[model samples]
Target: MSQKKTVYIGPFIQCKTLTDLDICPNGMIGVDEGGRIAFVLRDERGRKIPEGDGWEDAKIVRIQDHGFFFPGFIDTHIHAPQYPNAGIFGKSTLLDWLNTYTFPLESSFADLATASRIYNRVVARTLSHGTTTACYYATVHVPATNLLADICQTRGQRAFVGRVCMHEMSPEYYRDESVETALRDSKACIEHVRKIDPEFDLVTPIITPRFALSCNTESLAALGKLHRELDLPAQTHISENPRECDLVRDLFPESKSYADVYESAGLLTPKMILAHAIHLTEEETALIRARDAKISHCPASNTALTSGRAKVRKMLNAGLNLGLGTDVSGGYTSSILAEAREAVFVSRHVAMDEGDEAKLSVEEALYLATRGGAKVVGLEDRIGGFEVGKMWDAQMIGLEAVGPETTELDQSAGPVEVFGKETWDDLVAKWVYTGDDRSTTAVWVGGRLVHAKEGFRL
Candidate 1:
């Protein structure tokens, strides 16, 4: 349980809806010992709010000048073990990139030492980037995957850890030996997560079939069976590349389309999170929406690998719940803010081809980062925004203000520059377009201080 009863005071920002941001110029929020928000109040005069049942010793954390508290990012899909190979996929698409850079690096996770080194850095790195919650795909090794669960639990970041299952089409050295071994090892990893977080309060287990081509028909069916029996959340890759989609046709001829392969295996459900649906047909789209499965758009990874642009606006219009994912090494960067920027850029490109309706405004992209992400992870009521009962999973964003306090040598304040004339929306747009990790000064998960950069204080 969290021991901190913290009172945070300052400006706050959140998605009021799909097209607008809820910006409170002066606000205060009280977090109780259990990490749930005890209350949220606002006043023009910045007056103090009433203290709750707890007698008056709550610690106070205030946002700095020109800063605001925004909901922490949720990365709905990422490969934890592939973090080492980030930005190394040079001139290769998904298939060849997997063969050359991804598999070889992921295979090294068989050594617990490598898993420890990389997992530690990846967790810290993502936390620094203001990712308070992540859905991670660890390597096939049970011990290594379990270590990842332990790291997230100990670090206080909300996570869903999955053991990657690729029974065939993968290299011999890294692939699961058989369908039985795949199920067994995946179960072992799930049990490990249970042991670490009994109620899955901070970390849970997800059944991850690497992709359709990597797993045979029997393995996918068996894994789906296990999913139903355990009632667990599932994740997998979908139609990411044109050639990969065509290959799925030849491999699973009986299935109607790429989405049908998982449907036939009973893996398409509300609890499933399918990443990179850049090439889904209308039938496949309707099927996924009917099933209520979520989508994690990875624009950076899609563009980095020269994958086709994902029609995010089209998906939203279909009434599908959508979220953003860094996709880590596959997409290159681990920062979700950068991924949000990529989403806007990719949407503009789509608008160029289609029409202006395809362009996603800054508000829409940020909504996908926070609120839409919460819906995708099935935690809409818990962590998406500031409310009377939501958990305090948030980040403090600071932009340098130009004034008498500014000096020529103060370059450490980060990439965003603000004059006295910009509105709140303009400031947010600047951060979305140009800001990086340096602007994410502090991060919190469930009222606990998970990450705080240098010079940040409570």
Candidate 2:
């Protein structure tokens, strides 16, 4: 078991802050053992009102005058094996880029030693970028996938890792064993790591079908059955590119649409997360909402590959569970704030051109990054908000650097006064528009300080 620790942080802000509406002026979340949270509310006498263990008199360890702490961002679609290609850009479409850059780069994860070195960098960078949890797709290499899973578990970040299962029609070098072998290996991986307590609990084995074109009908059906039998979450790409959609149509002629391919195979369940629902017909949208599945919007990747904008506003109106993703490598950066900004910008652009009856709001986007994302990963009840009794998975962004006061002063005074105007919405707006990894000064997962900038280690 990991060591027990208690820490306090303050002078922060959060928009739509979840602590309370009555007296709680800001979102102040507390974390205790097992990554649990205890939101503090003081009585009239100023005595601490407790929610869980170690609530009273917890020692203060760090203080940030201009920090805004909120629930850490959750990435629902990213490739751990593709970490080496984090900044690969300038592609016109998905299939073209996959062939030109993505596949060639993914094939490298077959090396376990190589995976070890890369996984560390991926986690370090992701933590630095304020992502406390991620849903990662590793290569079919079981050992390499295992290495990646182990790193996430030991390092105390929530991760849903799929052992990149693919049985037919992929590049020879990157493809995995037969369907039966893939199933058995995936099940074994699930049971293997689930025994390691918190780290293992943080790690879940998701059944990943590379895509419709990559997996044969038999393979998709088998994995779908495995997900139902094991009660596990499943993920895959869907309707991401027009060419890929056409390929899916050619591959599965009987299906009316691309979404039907998975629906027919019994994979589109509430437990499933479909990445990039950029090309959904009304029927597909109905089915998606009916099944309660989620859409993982990768705005950066969509624009980077010219796949067109996802109907985010329509998806939300249809009552679909939706979240944002960097789709890094495909996306140039791992910042969810960047994803949020692009999500709004692209949605408005699409609405203007197509004149779709949908609008995206800043509050809606922030909700997607937090609660909507947690739902996509099947952790909505336990990990999304700064409420009492939720997991204390939070991050602190220093708003001091990007406030109005800095602009008011000349470059001589060091500009420390602007931080006071950094309200929750102001902080988040600045974060979405101007922030990067440097803005993230501290990260805490399950009540433990996992990442901090300069001279502090947990």
Candidate 3:
């Protein structure tokens, strides 16, 4: 978190649009003391400073030939309390999975010591994987939920923290006691975040109803009213499982559909982020579009939890805003790079059943990972790309080049091998398919150095 001016020079790549990547082979970008990008110059030679305004001693970060700087990732849906259970779903689906593995694990967060240890580790891990922004769901406990916001603030990660509310049908030991208690606890968490980051420049509070099945009409309506009154963004699950949809129908017989449940409660709005819209109907999609709500396509979790594939191409064709979510624990990973690649495979599966037109290219998936994710979290104007005024929320990605003298392969750069034959697009595709956190040498959020691998220096 240096207050002095800094300049990053060398290859820079970012998604300028959904279908285009802005690849500047040699570029120079300046960041002022307050962390906003001051100027951008393309094809600059030899780390030359912009004609001076007293920046002779500015810090310089130069990237290697095989590396490029890309925008940091955004995870729109993930459970902060379930990070330990990643890759442990076994043979369970939604409801049974919640009862058997999810609830009991989440209930343990009532302990502050347990909450602090896990929150710190998960935040560090995600930042290591180049995730600068995330929308996190915390348990019903107020103290632990507030602790998560504090951790994100301290770690310099941009986050939307929400205290989950499920006043009915959830287990007695874990559910919120009543609607009043649910709203009261949620307000306390919001106030706690405001106290820490008063302007919400780094962290903000989000409304969480924990999906329709876990909440009754009274609690949902009350939470919805709170959302409107506070003018805060919200995140929740939707149509992730067939059994869950059936349960929603039985529980609220008056509602027309799963989307109707939220609409009736006033929870569906432009600020709402719906995760895993895998089984959404045409009408339901239309209603969501009409409301201008956002969608977080968690492909890794959908396939792991046995949820059906989401029709992402259709959503885009219908002019919907969509992004990627790790949905960790259910997703079995914290890396959004893995999530972006999984989205490619999920789109291929979708194309197999529907048509080839449903397929998503590597460029499209990366856009969902960066630009679309920024849109989902309501920070498109501030982050997600390189521009004159946007903050520097980005990661430096390095790929190992194979030379003739190589005897043993380097394990630090992961499995992606660049042999000097790849086009710019091919190189990007290789990383998307096989790259891991090893390729992320350094990460920054709002010009603050948050995480870096061993031996990496500016």
Off by over 4 Å in 1: 44-46, 404-409
In model 1, the Cα lDDT at residue 299 comes to: 97
Model 3, 216-306: lDDT tens digits are 9998899889999999999899999999998999999999999999999999999999999999999999999999999999999999989
Question: Which residue pairs does candidate 3 place in steric collision?
Answer: none
Judging by lDDT, tell me the better candidate of 1 and 3. Answer: 1
lDDT of 1 at 257: 98
Give per-model TM-scores. Answer: 0.98, 0.90, 0.98
Candidate 1, poorest ten consecutive residues by summed lDDT: 43-52
Tens digits of per-residue lDDT for model 1, 1-458: 85768888888999989999999988888888988998888753547657557627888888887889999999999999999888988999989999999999999998999999999999999999999999999989999999999999999999999999997778989899999999999999999888878899999999999999999899999999998899999999999999899999999999999999999999999999999999999999999999999999999999999989999999999988999999989888999999999999999999999999999999999999999999998889998899889999999999888886766857567889888899999999999999999999899999889999898878
In model 2, the clashing pairs are 35-446
Give one digit per residue, the lDDT tens place, for model 2 in 134-158: 9998877777777878898888788
Q: Which numbered prediction scores highest in lDDT against the true structure?
A: 1
Candidate 1 lDDT: 0.92
Q: How accurate is candidate 3 locally (lDDT)?
A: 0.92
